[model samples]
Target: MSVLDTAFVDTELSKKTSIFGLHLWVVIGIVVGAVIVLIPSNLFASLPRAAGAAARALPEIQIDMGKVEHRVVFSDRGASSGESRATSGAETGSFGDENVIGEGGYGIVYYGMLADNTKVAIKNLLNNRGQAEKEFKVEVEAIGRVRHKNLVRLLGYCVEGAYRMLVYEYIDNGNLDHLAYLHEGLEPKVVHRDIKSSNILLDRNWHPKLSDFGLAKLLNSERSYVTTRVMGTFGYVAPEYACTGMLNEKSDIYSFGILIMEIITGRAPVDYSRPPGEVNLIDWLKMMVGNRKSEEVVDPKLPERPASKALKRVILVALRCVDPDAQKRPKMGHVIHMLESEDLLSRDERRIARDSSSSLREEPSASRLEQQTKQ
Candidate 1:
């Protein structure tokens, strides 16, 4: 069994064994409960020294406290004497759905104002663990220095006691997690290791700006590929990257293909709500293509059916983008070319157009000797 399967089996078996040993467990539980009842209540209370030591053990990511103070406005409840606070008012600063911009793995991004009334998106990180702290620094150092028109700029950060937060320039339309946002042309060669719908954000002009650089890797002049631990959302990960941990721009291409299909179908990569055979997007797509029922793959909720030719081209491009072999996958620029070209879905058409093409060319089957011929 695979490691993941083994882990799952062991967990399920452990649960079943616990259930079967209920009587013995109950007896042991009673003794443990009696022993706990005899122990002092003070032991259960907060142990500040231990908590402090644990927090201090991890390498601290430096933050300019002066810059953070300008944007982070803590209320009386949020801050205490000798702590950072914007005001002495008992009410908390604006940070909610009413002013809520977006949400991600890190935390809720709130539309809020700085002391100078500058509009900002404040990400309130929910986790305070050491690993989470590293992610915080990763995001800050990764995108904080660079200024790009297509990327949401990280303005500053705040770290007070256990609370950690980041401030970003607010994008009015929010994110594409629900596949609800659509942005115009954005051509960046950067490989977003995690390219799910949620990581895309729409601006005031309906332009999509990619967000969440926490899992992103820059393919600079120095290097274009790396072999590391497989990391990313399941359905969007490339077959090559998932199997061998070999990552490059094509890995993101594979994920982008999945994202396009997500936009087309309004379906997530994996959904238990779907039928057994239709649970996975790629598997379902292949099944549909094999059955020549590709038309059925489009989301029924769409207001109007897209032209068959246009739709076919889209599906063809998506299929090519997700080809199993990493070498066969097209660059993002070429994928864009296919999307814009009409009647350019088939290999023959693309080949005639003088565009570079790759194939799923299968190997010939080995010949087996017939009984009569052998005799």
Candidate 2:
């Protein structure tokens, strides 16, 4: 599928309400109930995700729209008192169906405008059983103090009676990019439990920005890994993480591999609509590669085909990232090196990647594996 096709699928899917929303919606609910995690992104490290060359840091402003009591809880270097007023009046109107740009179990994301006409995405969280409240806290904690070129910016938040909302700098386009910063750049590694195509957004310039931190987990240096109940999207969750509930940066590397496959093939991680052999993306891709039919894996919709060597490098990198053994998966930094290098992988690395793909043929489906793990 092409970029256009992915957009169409998203449009059709989001319009229909099924369980929490669609695809791995139910799995996401499990993640919210448990402690979530995050991944990394280093694409365009010098280019900021927000607009303008002179990036301005925003404060976490808490607004009581009902009682007209508002205060800035966390202020950054670039934030100003006047800027707080700009976001205070953002939620003056109703968030009807027309304003909704996206939706999930957590809440509806609406396209709103500030007094200065700055475009923003307002997440109208559903505070059912306090899940939204918890999500809000996690999201804020994950990104409130950090600023990255590849991560979306949290402008502010609002609390009006039962209404809970988060304001974010609106990103118009939809795409994905490198995520090495979260794993290597930060002191306490941030592991994004849910790393899928939908969570990544793009700006007008087409620079990909990683979004949605409601399922992000922060891992300190003291602990090697955090063992919690299973969390994360079904097919994107790492097998070891799903089976043992041991989450670390490597689990994120596995999800990133799935995401790479999604971009290259324009296919969902798990799709039952396809033929039996082609239903599971990883299984199908592995079969194709194992049979030396790797050329057939690229999306047919791509206007121009990639050179064989370039394509081979991408496939090998993805296979390595998704290796069943988290220990075998390369670090995000090494993954980036593989992606950027114009040269092909060494023969040894190529054999390892190929073996990695072949090794998964006997394993159960990603969703089934995760479900069985949960059981």
Candidate 3:
């Protein structure tokens, strides 16, 4: 944990009073964030009481109070070379209105082009209750220095008082919540709590980009679980996270499992239109996989050939990810391995074995791993 300066703590806390008698925890969260900003990134592995308590809170950013500048520009680059198109909200009144790509709980995303004709998606956060500020800090903290082909780029940001905005490279298609395929890279794991299809966006070449960092949580390399409030789409949430507030990388695996089912079956996680017992994808898929009738749940529209080999493998991996017991679930590495394997059983071969089975089998989800002890 980074050390906190006692004098600095007294100075900042004295300046700001909790207007609404906000909970001590919330105030402490801010104090912790303030302290974190004064330290180095490598020291983030261990945070003191305040920071550890508020798992979702971001480290405080140093704003130049003297300038009182209407526009605040924060970028991944050391120094922004020219007038940025994203900071227009501070100078004028709008980010960009030419095209509205999408809108969500965080803010509205606009499609625009920069001076060099570089296309970008600018997010102007609705600074309603400081949610935008937290989102900006978290996104920058989680992904600012990290780069991956599968992840969306966090190009820049504008923190002009009440106006908090983010700039990202525009994705051609929508979020993964629109598309249904993607898994996290667990080595230095970043859990995208809300893993619905809409969060998955597609680029010009059709590669998926994962976006939205408001509800994201970064796990320290040495830690196995992060304790925090459970926030995510209802159907896509892992059972363990929903029941208990404990979350780890497996939580993402479970959501990915649900996503796979959605991709293959063309069904949402929760559909009341379906039969009573099978309303939840988790429950329905469990029944299908156990009955040795996994083939029954595939999307009818998926062409026959690839669906048999690739689709079955996809479903199998999805099932592994969604396994009710977090411990029983396979790691993302193992899941990917299975997905790419050629010799895995085909639908017909697996069905033959299922037909001869005398009794029902327990799947990872149905069997349920013993409740995990809080880490």
Question: Against the true structure, whose lDDT is highest?
Answer: 2
Better model by TM-score: candidate 2 vs candidate 3? 2
Q: Over the full model, what C-alpha lDDT does candidate 3 score relative to the true structure?
A: 0.53
| Alpha carbon RMSD to native, model 2 | 11.4
Query: What residue runs in model 2 are displaced by over 4 Å at the alpha carbon?
Result: 1-93, 125-139, 158-164, 174-183, 227-231, 243-245, 347-375
Q: Candidate 3, residues 1-375: lDDT per residue as tens digits? A: 111224542354334333212222112221221121122334324423353443332212221223333333434431121122222223332333546777765578877555556676777666345445554465455444455555577665655546665667777656433243343443455676766667766576645556764345777789988876667777888988988878887887787777767866767899999889878876777677556555577666433323333444556566656656687676665555544455554455344323323223544322221111000
Worst 10 residues of 3 by lDDT: 366-375
CA-only RMSD, every prediction: 21.4, 11.4, 18.0
C-alpha lDDT of residue 169 in model 2 = 76
lDDT of each: 0.51, 0.58, 0.53
Off by over 4 Å in 3: 1-99, 105-107, 112-117, 124-139, 160-164, 173-188, 213-215, 305-313, 344-375
What digit string (tens of lDDT, one per residue) describes model 1 on residues 1-375?
122134442353223212112222111211111121122323323223342442221111222223333233222111111123442233344553576666655566767665556566666766544435454455444435443445565665665656677666667666634321111122222455776777666576644455654335544446657776676777888988889987787887787778767756668888989999989887777566555565677777544455555555556566666777676666655665555444333545344222212233221000010111112
* Order of candidate numbers by TM-score, starting with the best: 2, 3, 1
User: Which TM-score value belongs to model 3?
Assistant: 0.61
- Model 3 RMSD vs true structure: 18.0
- Clash count list over all predictions: 1, 15, 18
